[model samples]
Target: MNIWESHRFGKRIHLTYHALRRMEERRISLDMVQDLIEKGTLIHKDEKYCWIFKSYSHRDDNLVCAAVIRGSAVVIKTLMTHWQEQPE
Candidate 1:
């Protein structure tokens, strides 16, 4: 696992063993997760990329990937909605 110097949630970010297991299953890279946690906006809920100095991503080379860094192994909690249900 690649360890990155990243900042996490303002307070405590709780994660679960099951979440970690899910991440592993999704094949989401740790570096990508680090980019999420270290950078992105929390409340904005924007996709494409993380928020490092108000950065919004325009790159689409990688779409099916999502990540978050920091927290106690449980950094992400996603509920795939209708949009995600559609075929690209």
Candidate 2:
């Protein structure tokens, strides 16, 4: 688990154990996660979860996203790459 107190956003963000493992497997760095949380587009949200997306120039997987649970402390559940927007 990893915790970041984001002064810019005024919230504590936690990367859960599962999220950490996924991040490593996906080759997603901590800095990328931070940027996603801070600047990514909010593509979906419900009462408890939010999906944030962003496009990066460095990778073949241009779009990456993060699944996060919203609360006093935002918990990042997972990270994904090569994300495609599904038809609603």
Candidate 3:
């Protein structure tokens, strides 16, 4: 897990290592994800199961993230159906 900071409205946010890598590889910002999370625009999985991470970008590039589910976290490139199997 990466360092997380809670926003004023109680949203957990941080620069994912993957996001940082993306920044280094290309150039993206976690700001979009942060904004969506803050505004509650991004609804990932329910709190009972999974929590989704968000990333923002000026370029039309795929956003990736890492998440801890069950007891492990892995890097993910897409959230489309069946993509969870890659992490599995």
Candidate 4:
């Protein structure tokens, strides 16, 4: 399998330091993010990254994240607890 596909199947995933900080600040648990990587949809993909999102509606907002998967790692580039617009 390809690296990204391997990651989706629970291969070793290393988060960047920035990603770790962002997850903590956003109160996003590692398990939550991991689940997204494993089961989230690939919303967008560029030459260097793949964006995966797992969205859930809570109250009037959406709890979601746009993760940038590069190589064998998933980096949480943007996370929103009450997202309004579709993640890019």
Pick by TM-score: which candidate is best? 2
Ranking by TM-score: 2, 4, 1, 3
Going through the candidates in the order shown, the clash numbers are 3, 0, 0, 0
User: Which lDDT tens digits does candidate 2 get at residues 1-88?
Assistant: 3898865458899998988998999899999999888888876567788788899999898689888887888888988998876777
Worst 10 residues of 4 by lDDT: 1-10
lDDT score, candidate 4, position 51: 59
lDDT of 1 at 58: 44
Show the colliding residue pairs in model 1: 15-74, 39-51, 40-51
C-alpha RMSD between model 1 and the true structure: 8.3
Q: If scored against the real structure, what TM-score would every candidate get? A: 0.37, 0.88, 0.36, 0.62
lDDT (Cα, tens digit) per residue for candidate 1, span 1-88: 4333334544444334554565466554455455555554343234422222213244333333233343344344431111121223
C-alpha lDDT of all candidate models, in order: 0.38, 0.85, 0.38, 0.58
Superposed by TM-score, candidate 3 places the C-alpha of residue 64 at a distance from the truth, in angstroms, of: 8.4
lDDT of 3 by residue, 5-67 (tens): 545334344454555565455543445444433443233454433434444444454333333
| Per-residue C-alpha lDDT of model 4 across residues 1-88, encoded as one tens digit per residue | 1123334545555566767677777777776776667777776567556656667443233455555755454455655555433545
Mark the regions of model 1 whose C-alpha exceeds 4 Å error after superposition: 1-15, 44-88
Q: Cα-based RMSD of the predictions, in order?
A: 8.3, 1.6, 7.1, 5.1
- For residue 55, what is the lDDT in candidate 2? 93
Of candidates 4 and 3, the better by TM-score: 4
